[model samples]
Target: MPQTEHGANRRRGRDETEEERADRMWTDLIQEVRVAQTGVQILFGFLLTVVFTPKYAELSDTDQTIYIVTVVLGACATGALIGPVSLHRLVSGRRIKAQAVRWASRLTLLGLLLLLATTSAALLLILRVATHDGFVPYLVAGVVAWFLLCWFGLPLWTRHRHTVK
Candidate 1:
């Protein structure tokens, strides 16, 4: 039994070493990235087709700008979500699982943030085109709030509340 720094058995039933822990974390991260990558890729694919639609020309200049920005953000999110695969392929068998996991986590975070922005912009553009109302900002704000809760607030709260010392 390995004594912990607090003079207790540190092993929590699974006596995984640092490398093994990193490998586990890496797999979990990859699974998470896969979910986000799939969503962003689908969204990016749809956004890419919007410009070819006849309705695109009917959009106001402001809405056109919003669509452009949203598409760009979606593209960025797609790239960020897929970055881990490229990173792993390039660094395969490099004996740097910990570093790779860290990088992948960073990329995933970036991807999520970009996804949030992309979704928000897309919602705003769609609502403005569909409603043409003065309350579009409020609608977009409410949707953004919901997204914040679902994507970030809940996860962070759970992590903080349940993480062991």
Candidate 2:
């Protein structure tokens, strides 16, 4: 085989073409999204019902605002995470699965970020309503930090550590 500028073979250890790689990636991404979608959908469903509860009328204005923001963020996350399926369906015969996969991956990342914000806001609202303590912000910050570390930091660390030079 002829050598490309980057290397003798861009595919390296694999025998798949770009389309095949995209297909595989799309499958993997869909599987990953299923997990996140379930959690976000459940959380969003719960948030939707919170407003109908009798206790919801008793929350302070600030807490009400937080709840609204959390619900909006959850909605955005749900849309972004589900965007891939819509994209795939609409573009099924367009021969653009590679591009679709890339776009879907971006949407998934955006969804995860939104999920992080939604979760943090929900936590803050809950803690504020539950304890009304000065330490609530600190506690929420700690939990956000933990989520960031676990969700992003570890994957990044491993990617950086194992990347071929």
Candidate 3:
């Protein structure tokens, strides 16, 4: 069992060396990243095509700006989500899997945040274009709240509830 700096035993179940732990964590992170990467890549691809669409030329200035921001956010999210693979490929056999995993995890989290922003912006622009009503903002805000609750609030609550003191 490996003890933490505070002298708490840290083994999840079976005994694992640092390298073994890193390997397991890396595998898990990769699995999670695959799902996010696929979604972001698809969204980014669709965003890329929107600029070439005939309707894109008719959008108002504000909507065009929102579309640009959404597209940029989607691109950034795609990069961050795919970053872990590049990080692992470049750092493999460097005896730094643990550090690499940490950085990859950070990138994944940032990617998720960017994805959320991209989705929100896309939704806002779509509703504004389709409805042109004041209720668009309210609807967007409600959906954003739902997304926050599902993506961050629930996970944080579960982690805090289950973590040992």
Please write out the lDDT profile of model 2 over residues 126-152, one tens digit for every residue: 999899889999999999999999999
Question: What are the models' TM-scores?
Answer: 0.90, 0.92, 0.91
Candidate 2 off by > 4 Å: 1-12
Those runs of model 1 whose alpha carbons end farther than 4 Å from true positions after fitting are 1-14
On TM-score, the candidate that comes out on top is: 2
Q: Which ten residues in a row have the lowest lDDT in candidate 2?
A: 6-15
Q: Model 3's lDDT to the true fold?
A: 0.94
Residue-level lDDT of model 1, residues 72-119, one tens digit each, is: 999999999999999999988999988999998999999999999998
The full ranking of all candidates by TM-score, starting with the best, is 2, 3, 1
Better of 1 and 2 by lDDT: 2
Alpha-carbon RMSD, each predicted model: 3.8, 4.5, 4.9
